[model samples]
Target chain A: MHKVVTVDMEKDILAENRRLADENRALLEEHDIRAFDFLGAIGSGKTLIIEKLVDHLKSKGKESAAIAGDVSGDDDYQRLVAHGIPAANISTGKECHLDAHLVDHALEDLPLDKIDYLFIENVGNLVCPVDFPLGSHVRVVVISVTEGDDMVRKHPAIFAFSDVIVINKIDLAEAMQVDPRILERDARRINPGAKIVKMDARHGNGLDDLISALGL
Target chain B: MHEFSVMSQIIEGLLEESKKWSAVKVEEVFLDLGDFTMLGEEQLKFSYEILSKDTILQGSTLTINHVKGTIECDCGFKGEMSPSEDSPHRIVPILECPKCRGPARIISGRECTIKNLRLVVPDV
Candidate 1:
């Protein structure tokens, strides 16, 4: 006769990803690399901000590398490489977020020894990326004013968990009829301890403030 | 969607657990899905149906028990939150404290886990 058996697993669904993230953290620490995971929605200017950060770091004599995670194209990867930064392109075939496993693989392709800083541009999504931690020292969430002031209120979890919140594209705030102060208030409300920075990454506005907020 | 990816991981865990139990067939999987996770139940079921095909977990019953989202405020208030009407979707939780109206820390609703499983095995 066949009998029924009950197994008490009580396991987290994302446990594997969490384990790998810890391993990635250890690996990064071993290599003395300060990695930042940039998360945002599409058109939030994550790539441009990263490019600007890389340039600033380079000018300070600090070498930087990047891993661009996209669903298909390597456009962001190309942009970073064109700016004279080492970057790896990860095409997350049907996945919406970059998990720690993917970052581990991308780390294999980078020159970890030569890099002082690493920027991981997660798949351009605010919602999905919130659940997956990619083993970065700092998690930066970039939201543009063009997306509207409700961006933070609508996606509170990402803003709440992130270490730094970047309100990019402030140059068009008036043209878009969006106020950066409202975004800052919302972010502060969601995460009081998080450092909030407003900037126009394209025009290099507020870059120094962002740099200071990042403790770079 | 990420539901497919999450379901894939669940299926892998189920299969491994079944092997440990020496089960001839898997029967049911119970999950505690938290409201704060923002994972769709229908999407998760659909993903399970697709990913479990031909595996030991095929045709298994997937039961999801939704856990209510809760938060704790620095002002010493703790409770659940109702979705704001302004939210685009009902699943998006309001992270502010109802009492203090300040940013509250999520205390429980973010969990996505396999609580347990049932298997069929030969009586030995």
Candidate 2:
């Protein structure tokens, strides 16, 4: 009573996401906003590093806005707002990473013309975030020394796709018994072109190198 | 964690494709997963099994083909870099050019695609 119904797809599973990302990129470009996707693990200082970068940019008279993605809570979003930076939060609920569609929606709330740079802080996960690009001009992955020296080797794909890699919490290197140089070396091994910077973002150390790396 | 979302996307795509032919049921699905993608096949299948319920894709067989990561470098190095030197339990992949140990452009093995689908259509 039934017959064969074969459908040949040969289509990329992430084609929808990639298409949305391209649209987001074009919109950001039209607004003359340089966007960066800040990717890292939870407690890797991505938020603090962003705070420091915001302060640094403020000193240079450059306005920067942020879009924070997290599973729950508005703590990060509130923190950025306390610093007077225009920002919005996207709660993924069950998702681990932020995709282009969510970002595209968030862009509607952000005042694009009032900012020079747009920072998208992706949900703090290394593995999944690399697969989702949020229309950022540059993608930076942050890893602290507390995560250990093998962090880069453990997640090479993030490093490979990243335009910059920030090695945060270097001030605690002696206590953590991890060398920042070794981490930088391993990161360079995986991605020779990635600009790697060591820092204690909590105290604003090494933010200049990161800023220069972004050409901001 | 993200596997569920990826599975949902596949199911949605399959449903749309089947609708184009007025399929009564989906029989099988063939997927091409690149080695560099790091998406777990077991997890994807588990997600699919649960998400496809009540849909035409229910009870469909999911076949996955792992495409190996291939590299091409300015140093004329072109081949697949073998698995890392880490222990058996911890397999860290080293994706670099074997010849110059430099940054090589990855030419392939980052694709995640739905290749084909088998479906059932009622007689006209």
Candidate 3:
């Protein structure tokens, strides 16, 4: 005879990812590495901000490495390498976001003992990357003024969860008719505890503020 | 999209659970999906259908219980939030305290869990 049974699972779909993330966190802690996960849309200056941060950290006698995540291209990886930053390129194939598992694998490929700060540049998309945590010490979301002042409000989840929100490309805010203050206000409304830093990353503006905000 | 990846996880979990129970087939899946996840129901179903093909879960029914997004603020305000009108997709909701209009912590609507499963097993 066949019988139908109702099984009580109560299983979290992202439980595995969360567990892996915790493991990554533990690994980072064990190695005393400060890792930051960067999330942003394309053209949000995430790469530039990371590049600048790596440069600044290097000047302070701190060693830094990066894991550049993209869908296919290794352009960001090349940029980081061109700057002499040790970076691993992670191609997610068709995936839109970088998960903890991918970061775990990337961590193996890096020189953990030689690194003080590890920057993980996630795939360039705001919405999809919000839910996935990559075992970083802090989660930074970058948004450029060219994206508009309402970018934070439109993508509340990402802003709400981020520890630091970088408002990049402020130099063009006037030309774009977008006020950086408006972006800051929106970010504050969404996540009051998040450190909001406005920057012209291309011109090296707000680097100190960002560094202080990150406590690095 | 990521729904495909998520569905694969669900199927993997279901299969493991079925193996433990010695289930011959899966009949239905009950999921509690939170609004904050921003996962489309259609996309999830499509992913499920595609991923479950030729598996024990083939032809199984998928039921998604959408959990509304709610928040709790330090100001003692607690309730559901409305989607931001300014959102281009009209799906991303404002996550501030409705009363105090300050940043609030998400209490629900981010869940993506498989609460239960209907399986076919041999009579013991």
* Predicted model with the maximum DockQ: 3
lDDT of 2 at B90: 40
In model 1, the runs with Cα more than 4 Å from the true position are B71-104
TM-score of chain B of each: 0.92, 0.90, 0.91
Model 3 chain A poorest ten-residue lDDT run: A148-157
Give the DockQ (2 decimals) of all models.
0.58, 0.65, 0.66
C-alpha lDDT (0 to 100) for residue A197 of candidate 2: 90
Report the C-alpha lDDT of model 1 over A172-203, residue by residue, as the tens digit. Answer: 99999998899998787667768899999999
Residue A27 lDDT in model 1?
94
Give the TM-scores of the predictions, in the order they appear.
0.91, 0.94, 0.93
Query: Which candidate model has the greater TM-score, 2 or 3?
Result: 2
For model 3, the DockQ equals 0.66
lDDT of each residue in A91-188, candidate 3, tens digit only: 99899999999999999999999889999999998878876888998999999999987777767779887889999989998999998898898788
- Flag clash pairs in model 1: none
Question: After superposition on all CA atoms, what RMSD does each candidate show versus the true structure?
Answer: 2.3, 1.8, 2.1
How do all the candidates rank in terms of TM-score, highest first?
2, 3, 1
| Model 3 stretches astray by more than 4 angstroms | B82-93
What are the clashing pairs of model 3? none
TM-score of 1: 0.91
